[model samples]
Target: MQIKHQVVTRTPLGGFTLVEVLASVALISIVAAYFVHIQIQQVQERVVEALAQDVLTLANASMTYFSQTNEWPDQENGDCDDLIATLGGLGAFPVAVGGYQGPDGITLATRCEDTGDLGRTLLISVNFPFGADDQAQMLMSYLPTSVNEDVDDDEGPVVTHYVATPRRASERYRFYRIALEERGIFRLSKPDCPGRRNDPAHILLPQAICMPASAQGLGGYFFDEIDDDDDYWELQLLVADGEENNNVSDFMEFSGIPTCDGNRVYVGAITYCETR
Candidate 1:
C-alpha cells in the first residue's frame, strides 16, 4: 500500500527540433563551402605552376631542335600574337612585335601572322668553292636558330638552307665547336647526329635523324690546312624552318685555319653575331 503512493513524472523523449536540425545543416553547408573554396584556389595555383613549367620545357626543347636542324621557327616580322595564331608551333616566341624589331627584321613579322599550326621549313643551301683550298682545316660555325622565321627583302624571297659538305660521324667527327662566344664543349649549330646509316638518300629525307654529338664536334677536315697552293675558298650555310616560313637572319660560321710546314704558319678561329 505504501509503495503504491509513489508518484511517476513523465520524462520528455523528443530529439532535435526541426529548426535546430535545419540550423545544423546550414552550418555544415557553410563549412563545406569554405573547404571547397580552398580546394579551388589550390587547384588554380597548381595549374599556373604547371603552365610555367611547360613554357620552360618548350623553350629548351625548341632551342635544342633549332640547334640540331639549323632551322628556326614561329618567328616573323610583324606582331607575334597574330603570327603565332597561324603557327601554333611557336612556344615562347614573343607574340606581337612590341613596336620594336627583333634582331632580324623578318623574325618579328613572321612570328605575327595567323596560320593553321606551328611548323618548320626544311631548306638547306650550301656554298663550297673547291678551288680556294689554301690548305685550311674546313671549319663550320652555327648561329642561334629561331623557332619562327621570315624573309622580307628579296623579291620572291629566297628561303635559307643549311648543310655540311661531308656531314658524317666517322668522316669528320673531330673537335669543332661554334657559339655566340667561343667555348670548349659546344658544337656547331647543326644536327649533331648522323642517321644510323650515313648515305645521301637517307640524309635527304624530309626529317632526317639528327646525329649525336661528336666527341670533337667538327668534321675531321674539309680539305687540307696548308696554304702551299694559295687557294682561297669559303663555304656558307642557309637553313629554313619549312616551305612556308622563310629564313629570318643571315647566319655566319668560321672554318679553322691550320698552319702548314711549306706555308707561313697561320691558325685562326672565326667569330660572328646577330644582324638586327
Candidate 2:
C-alpha cells in the first residue's frame, strides 16, 4: 500500500499566454470601434433629416401664414426668429416653436417681398456657419433640385452676408424662392415683342420672344441681383410653332429670348430663367 501511494502524480492545466490575451483585447477594441463609427454616421444622417424637416416645416408654416393673412411674415435679414414667433402665434405650430431656431446650427435669413403682380415671393437663404461645410453640403442634397442647382452653379442666388461669421470655402448662402401666387407677365420692349401693344391676337407669333416678368425692384425676379451692367437683358426668341429648326441664328434676332437652353440664361453669369 505504501509503494502504490508513492507512485501517484498529476500535470497542471493549460492557460492562455499574455500575448494571446492582448490579441483578444485588440480584436474586441476594433469591433467596438467599427460599431461606434456606424452609430455616429447614422446619428449624423438623422440629424440632417431632422434639419431638413425643420426647413420644410418653416416653409409650410410661412405659406400658411401668407394664405391666411395675404401677406408674408416679414424677414428683413436672415434671422427668422421673429417670423417664427409670428407663425407660432398664428397657430402654425402644434407646440410653439420657441427660441432662436434655423435648421439645426445653420442660420436662416430670408427676404420676403411683394413682387408686384408676380404675387408675393419669399427668398429663403440658408447660411452655413463656420465649421458647418459638411452639414451644408448634406443639407443641399436634401433641398429641391432647382435650389441645389442654384447653389451649385454659384452664378445665381444673391449672396448676402446676413450671417456675420466668416464662411468656409465650401460654405455659402443658398437661395430658393416660393411664389405665393401666379407670376405676372412682363411686357417686353416694343421692338422685341412680336405682337402690337394693343392687340391680343398676335401675342403668340411663330418667332416671337417674351417671358413672364417680375417687379423690377424686387430680388429673385428675372435675376437675383439686377445690376447696372445687367440692365439691358438679351434673351433668345421662342421657337415658332410647327418649326423643326433649333438653330441659334434663327432665334437670335428675337428680342424676347431669355433662356439659354430651356431653363437657364446668361446675365453676367449663367443663371436660371425658367420660361413660364
Candidate 3:
C-alpha cells in the first residue's frame, strides 16, 4: 500500500468575468438613476399640493375667525405674518391679487383705518399655474377653523372686505362682510349660523344678499381689486343657486369646496358685503 497526497485547488465561486461585472454595474446605475428621478418629481408634486392646501386653510381660518369675533384676524399678529408662517411668506403666492409686490412686487399690503380699534386690513391673491384669471364668484356659505378669541374690542359693525366680479378690463368690485356673534369669543362649535339649515341665508347678518355688479359707491357694487386694500367686490357663487357657475373659476377648485359642476373647494373668500 502507498500513501497518496492529492493536490487541492480552489476555483472562484462565480463564473462571471470582468465584463460581466461591469455590465451588471451599468444596469444597476440605470435603475438607481430612474428611482432618483421619480423621487424628485414626487417632492415637487408634494410641495404644490401643500401650497394649495395652505391657501385653503388660511382662507377658512380667516372666515371662521371673522364669524366668531366679527373681525378679521389682525394683520400684525404673529399668526398673521404672510409667508413667514407660510411657505410663501408674502412671496408664498405666485401672484398678488390683493397682496402687494410693489414696484418690484408687494405681497399682502394691509391698511389700518387710523381709528386703532377698527382693525387692520388684509389682502392676499394667488394664481394657479392654470385657471381662469380674475373671475368673480360668491361665498354663500363656508366653514373656517381657527381664531384668537382672547383679543377683543368691537371696532365696527362687522368684518368687511371687497371682491370684484368680472367686468371691463377695469371697474369691478363688491363688498363682503363677515358678521360675528361677538367681537372676541372664538366659538369651537359649527358657527352660530342660526338660520343656515332651513332659513337659507348668509350666516352673518340677516337678509342683505350678496349680488354681482359694478357701479359707483354706496349701493352700486361690482367685483375688482387692483391691489391689496383695493375697493369694491362681487358675489361668490352660491352653492345653492347658479350665481357662481364655478366651473374651475375659484381658488378652491382643486380643494373640492363647491362649484358650478357641483363639487367642493376648501377655498373661500369675502366676495360681497352689503352696502348698508
Candidate 4:
C-alpha cells in the first residue's frame, strides 16, 4: 500500500458570485420603483376626480338656488369662503361635496352678471387659486368643455364677461376657471340704438353701438351675421315657456332689415342691424 492518504480538498458552500448578487439587488430595486410610480399615479387620478365631482356639486347647487330664489349666492362677491357662508345662510349650499374641506384658496366669483337679455342671470364661477398650476392644468385637460384657461377679457358667457385669472405680483399663477353658466346669447343692437351702448361687444370693439334688446322690454334677439342675405335671416331667441327655468329657443325669420321696433322678428326690437 503506497501511502494511501488521499489529498483532502475543501469547497465553499455558497455558489452565488459577487456580480450575480449585485445584479439581483438592482433588479429588485427597479421593480419596487415601478410599483411606487404606479401607486402615485393612481393617487393623483383619484384626487383630480374627487375635485371635479365636488365642483359639479357646487355648480348644480348654484343652479338650484337660482331657480328657487331667482338669485345667485354671490353676495360674498369674489371671496369663495364668504360666498359659501352666504349660500349656507340661505340654506342653498350642498350638504357635502366629496372631500371639500372649504374653499382652501379656491375663489368663487360672479362674472358677467345678468348676461343675455334675460335679466338678472346668475353667472357664477369657480376659480383655481394661485400656485395650483398642476391641479388646474389637470382639470382643464380632463374637462375641456367645462374648463377655461387664459381666456381674454370680454370672452366668456358674454362678451364683457372677461375671464382673467387672479395673479399675485410678478408670479402670475396659472389661470383656471369654470363658468357656472354656459355661453349665452349675445344681446345685439344696431347703431344709433335707443339705449346706452352697454353692449358687451363694446368692451373690445369700441365702435360697437348695439344695446341689449331686453333693455327695451323686448325678447332676446339672435345675431345674424349677414342680414342682407335672406338665407341667414333666422332669428334664434330663448323664450321661457311659462315654466320655471324652462327656456326653449324660438326661431323667427325676416326678409329685410328689421326696424328698431322689430318688424318680423320675435315681435321685439331688432337692434342688431342698420336699417335700410
Best by lDDT: 2
For model 1, give the 10-residue run with minimal summed lDDT.
200-209
lDDT of 3 at 153: 40
Candidate number with greatest TM-score: 4
Off by over 4 Å in 1: 1-6, 62-269, 274-276
What would the TM-scores of all predictions be? 0.30, 0.41, 0.26, 0.42
Candidate 1 C-alpha error for residue 6, in Å: 5.6
Error (Å) of candidate 3 at residue 125 is 6.8
Error of 4 at 6 (Å): 1.6
The collision pairs in model 2 are 78-109, 186-213, 206-240, 209-256, 235-257, 236-257, 236-258, 237-257
lDDT against the true structure, per candidate, is 0.31, 0.43, 0.32, 0.41
Model 3 lDDT per residue over 1-276, tens place: 999999999986958899999999999999999999899766655544454354455555554544544344453354344422333343333444554332212122222232222223333333222221111011111213212122134321111232211111111122233321221111111211111121111222222323233243223212222223222222232221223334433211111222223422222222222211
Taking all chains together, the TM-score of candidate 2 against the true structure is 0.41
Residue 68, candidate 1: Cα error in Å is: 7.4
Between prediction 1 and prediction 4, the one with superior lDDT is 4
Candidate 2 error regions (>4 Å): 1-12, 68-70, 75-82, 94-98, 102-106, 113-121, 126-129, 145-276
Better of 1 and 3 by TM-score: 1
**Please, what are the lDDT tens digits per residue for candidate 1 over residues 195-252?**
3333111111111111234444422212111122212212222222223222233212
